[model samples]
Target: MGQTSTSLCCIFICFMLAQTVFQVESANILFFFGVSSYSHRLPAWPLVTGLAEKGHNVTFLSPFKAKNPHPKVVDYAPRKFSEWAESWDEMNMFDMRKKGDMYKQWLILPYFGIAMCEKLYSDEEFINWVKSSTYDLVFIDALFNECGYGMAHIFGAKVIQFDTTTVFPWYSSAFGSPDETNWIPDMAYVFGANEVTFQNRLINALIPVGWDLFRSWIYFPQLEEITRTGLSTTDLPTFQDIEKNVSMIFLNTYYSEEFARALPPNMVSIGGIAYVEKRTPLPKDLAAFLEKGNGFIYVSFGTVADLQKMDASTQQAIIGALQSFPELQFVWKLRNDSLLKEFPNGNVYISNWMPQQDILSHPKIKAFITHSGLIGIQESIYNAVPLISFPIFAEQDYNAERVHRNEYGIRLEITTVNQAELEDAISKVVNDSKYDPDFKFTQYSTNDA
Candidate 1:
């Protein structure tokens, strides 16, 4: 009896040791890079959440909050911008329309450089946080121009580049394109005006050269000194190099919705990563309001584009247009309460914050009026809703162009939009059978691929 009892005790001890070994082997540390923008954070959220759920530790290095905070997350503190610097609050899509191409190229180009430097150099807390944490892998947004890639290099960890934009030359190379083409891959051919014109090609070529010059001559020299790091302006790697060295490239896009292109082994299309929530419940007030409507057209310029920045007349015009379409309810995400009050009709429901994903997934939502942020575009594709894209800045113009070319939506220039144009665009999207058919096909292909 004593011998048998001793054998059982030994077996139990061995089982506990094996369990501990398995737990340690399964554990890993993942570092994420996110800039201040809401769009940048949105895509990373799913991966971070998934990793944590799988019992891995995630350290998110960003100036924004993680959407779904997890116990495993080690969030770095937010950084402040300089006094002369424009806060994210100062940025709006209208700036692109009001400023024109020349101003945008000059002012905005440098702005990104400065913003990157500020986030990396001024934020000592972030630098310290990164140095202290040891990560098995790093996932960075492509726009984290200075910090993400740089940190990954500093830590000597495997990196993954996450693109929130449509195909640019750098991205194209990952998919085995030997050279950058001016062609918009998916719909450019369908649009008939696709392919790079000589002038367009020339301009595209010059922009990168000019950008390199700007970075080398101005941005990098200043940044190197501030950070006390050896990173020179010329030290910046091309998108190709970043893609090559990284573990993989995950685009916030899908194959069906995008121009089908051949990709490298390291590049993966995991579009609609943001829509993983099976059916997140909407806020009670917003859900109740949505239920009351026959069907709704969801209008939002995403998180960055402030409705208040739009001229009051433009705002009124939008309200009037929505009111005219009484049969179709309008759920406008207007940030300012005054603007919401201006449209008091029960047909139009205003919310400072809405469950965007829930509303998009709702069967009652017929159309999406968006600013063409990658996240918003992906959500529209996932929900299979027709779009009216009014792109403001950054990659939005690129996203909007693709949507129009794909025949899934109409692209309205925000600077020139009016009631008639807005109404016409909405009518075309809602009335056109081809739009929905193409959209559904695109969604299917994206998911299947």
Candidate 2:
């Protein structure tokens, strides 16, 4: 009996020691997203919230504050670069699309990024905080928001970069992934999946290569200088060095929607990171509005689009399109409430904002009119809502092409779209069952391949 008791005590102590050795401690994570829009914030939100819930301390640093706050997450919002963003000129962008001046747009992005980094680095409080803080991991935005690389160098932490969209051409080069422009067109090319031909293939290849060279020669140098100046040290490594050693990259794309392409092991697709199975209740007024008509078609140009700044003709085209579908109620996500008076149709309900996912989840929602933003497209697919996609800028046209290719919706070129064209697109999506997104086929989750 004595021997058995002693053996049992020894076994218990061994078990305790094993537990001590195997236990995983919570980490300090810094999510640095400088000079980004609200759309950039949503895709990585689940990651932030997930880490926080798992007992890690998460610092979410961005100009945009959290729409929904989590207990374990700290939202750090510094000065917003509203002036820089506003200067981009919404009208100029529309004009550029009309004139096919897409190449010129890429030239301005680096300047914006450098300016944003300078703004962040200028804040004395932000600098002091960075100096004092110790992070185990740094998650940085892969856009012009590369300034966060300096912080990762300081903390000596593993870096994780996230792209809010599918891997761009620059991403392919930087991460050493196969771009294969012969078969796969650049995101800026604005062509269908199968439209990559011999003539435009050279153009596709050169665009990314040129952009990469511009970044390597001009953008990175300026970024390196500013980062060093901000940190007050020349001892830091170059952005390229830090970027090459990054631990992982999370892309906001799914395989089922994409053409077959080779990917590096470190690049992960966390497409439905923001997806939630449960739906939230809509506001009283919004709920009442949805209940009134046979069904509503949801329209939103996305977070960054300044529809108010759009020319009067385009605004009238949109308004007229909604009026054409008088039988079907229209729920438009327009920011200017006063502009509601411009819509003569009583069936049109305009609000600055509404719970988009909840509205999409509603049984009465017949179709979605979108800017073909990836998040909106994913959510629309998840809810089996057909789309009327009008792509504006960035990779939206690419996304719109996919929507059209998959028979998920109709893609309208916003530059050439008139009231009649808009009306026809809306009419087809609302009336035709062929446009309905195949939820089972397209729906992706964290577990998706």
Candidate 3:
């Protein structure tokens, strides 16, 4: 009996030891965020940093290097492709808004994607490093980085797609997810969840199919050519095959905010990865400013919107609206400080950069006037702050529609943002109890740390 008990104890000890070993085991992960914008990189930071913290060695490749990077995370900023970001800076979104032709916008994507691939391929040092290293898994930006699929193939690593935005319309066929355009609106459209008209549905259906054809017939061939040349081998899987075989997709979407849809088993929603719930102490002057005049509302058009480009009428309208709300202070984020002279009101606090997270979490923040970028929308929702969306470009309109449909805020067209409309939106969002902060949505965020 004593010998039998000893053997059982020994077996239990061995089992626990094996479990500990398995828990601590780490793998080499390659995270490639092809986009250089801070908006794209911000969502991926928590994941990369978390991996490094868990003892996994992460190799991060992007044009923008992270600040206060982890010791285990190696960053490589390829200089050649960094210039492509300059075009984004020069992209006049105001023009796109005026033209109202989405096809023109779509045409630019193929060129941008192809150019990015060619630039990355031409970097011999980066190519050599890719050849020399071994990666257990490769995480690629799902937006404009199809070349990363080939890189994963080179290292014989499992591929994971990191979508900074919600799933694209064409991602249905690629990722084996449902399109369900009958109710689910396209990201570019401002149709509400319940406002899916026949015309909206027809356009939504046709848009995804057309986009797929463009990608498959035009974009994929050029991308594959550059990818093959980069890898120095033509004998590799096509983009279609690689995309279909992706091990998993880390989608930046949540059901609490998005329409419910069936997703493939391999797809995971890790939305709100960038949202910080804990409130940080605000600076003294900023804190004092917010406490005055029946609390303040924060206004920001995000990183890309050039407020200086706004026509004089629109600019004056915005200024007039801000002045009209004298009882309530306004904190505006403008990139160009020259506009500061125009906003010379005691109630309006204009700054080039504001601590967005801290501002949202402040007790005195009554509402957020935003460009309706998904990141900003998510941050505002998690903080339980109501919004007044002045959508600029891209999916901002779509996000604003959701805000409007959900009764969390209102959406206004930037092109026609007059003082009357702006004042009405502010008044509705501030005084309406239905638009007040609902803390329940905070539970929807998948941020563990």
Candidate 4:
């Protein structure tokens, strides 16, 4: 009996020691993000929240305020851009529509880069705050050209790149993931060829080589001054080292969304991170509007897609389309008050800010009219609602194209949208058994996958 009791005590001590070791080795992650879009913010929120729940310390750096700040978070707001420059509404849609001129949009990358540099260099308060804190891991959104990669060198920490969309060849190359292929599927199925082509294959090969030379010549000098002490210059990690050093890559897309792509072992697809938490309660008015539902449709052009850019005729056409389908309730998230005032009927409910998640989860929401932003698309998938995708800009075109190709929704390009086409698309999504069932089935399959 005495021997058995002594053995049990030894076993308990071993278990306690193991638990202590694990608690000590657990990661302390610092997340850096360019909160340019709400969609970009959503994907990281769950991961940050999850790490915090596991008792890991997380410090998030962003330009905008966090929607739901966690206790473990250390919010770092960078310098804001000028009002005119910050207004995504003012951005030239015609210019954005142009393809293959990445340098023209180079301004976007630098804008966030400068903002991050300012926070790291000029913001004495933030520098003091970070210097006092300690982190073992750094998670940076790939688009944040300034902070994440640079900080890993400065702090001697392991960096993880978090991609909010499809893994672009340029980024894949930067991570030293082999420049073997470039023909990825088109997020939007516009062109005849696969998303990537022989042309992109050449471009993919050149981008890393060019970027390395460019960074070595131009970017590294500036970064060196900022990161290094006056006596010693810091050595930047090679593209291969960055890739090799990363613990994991988190993708916002699921397997169903990204078909026919080779994913690396380090890459994890936790697509619906935004929907991981229970949704917040809807406002009283919005809740009442949904509760009375004879089956309603939710419409929004997403954050970056300027609904204000739509001509008066287009707005009227959308209103006319909604009016045509009187039996179906319409919950339109309109930015313009004039547009809302034009549709003040009992059947139509209009709000400048609709609780998107709550609205999508509502039982009465039969279909979503979206600009096909990744977040909106994911939400629609999560809710198993059919989509009327009107792609406006960026990957939205790709998202809409995929929705149509997948048979989960209909696509109506903004440039060609008319009242009849809009009405027809909504009607088909609502009444067609094929569309909704396929959407739900795809959702279920994706979840299982």
Off by over 4 Å in 4: 1-26, 79-89, 92-120, 127-132, 176-244
Candidates sorted on TM-score, descending:
2, 3, 1, 4
For residue 93, give model 4's deviation from the true position in Å: 3.8
**What TM value does model 3 have?**
0.90
Clash pairs, candidate 4, are 187-398, 188-398
All candidates: CA RMSD (Å): 4.4, 3.4, 3.9, 4.8
Each model's lDDT: 0.67, 0.81, 0.80, 0.68
lDDT of 2 at 76: 83
Which digits, one per residue and each the tens of the lDDT, describe model 1 over residues 298-324? Answer: 999877788788876777677777867
Regions of candidate 3 where Cα sits further than 4 Å from its true position: 1-23, 192-195, 437-449
Give the Å error, residue 103, model 3.
Answer: 4.9
Cα-based TM-score, every candidate: 0.83, 0.91, 0.90, 0.81
Model 1 ranges with Cα > 4 A deviation: 1-36, 79-86, 102-110, 170-177, 185-196, 205-222, 229-244
Tens digit of lDDT per residue, candidate 2, span 201-234?
8788787788789879988888889889988987
**TM-score computed on alpha carbons, candidate 4:** 0.81
Candidate 3, residue 281: Cα displacement in angstroms equals 2.8
Better of 1 and 4 by lDDT: 4
Which stretches in model 2 have alpha-carbon errors above 4 Å?
Answer: 1-22, 80-92, 193-195, 342-345, 437-440, 444-449
Q: What does the lDDT read for residue 208 in candidate 2?
A: 77
Residue-level lDDT of model 4, residues 52-134, one tens digit each, is 88878777776566766778766666554223225555665533543433244543554546444544555566555555666
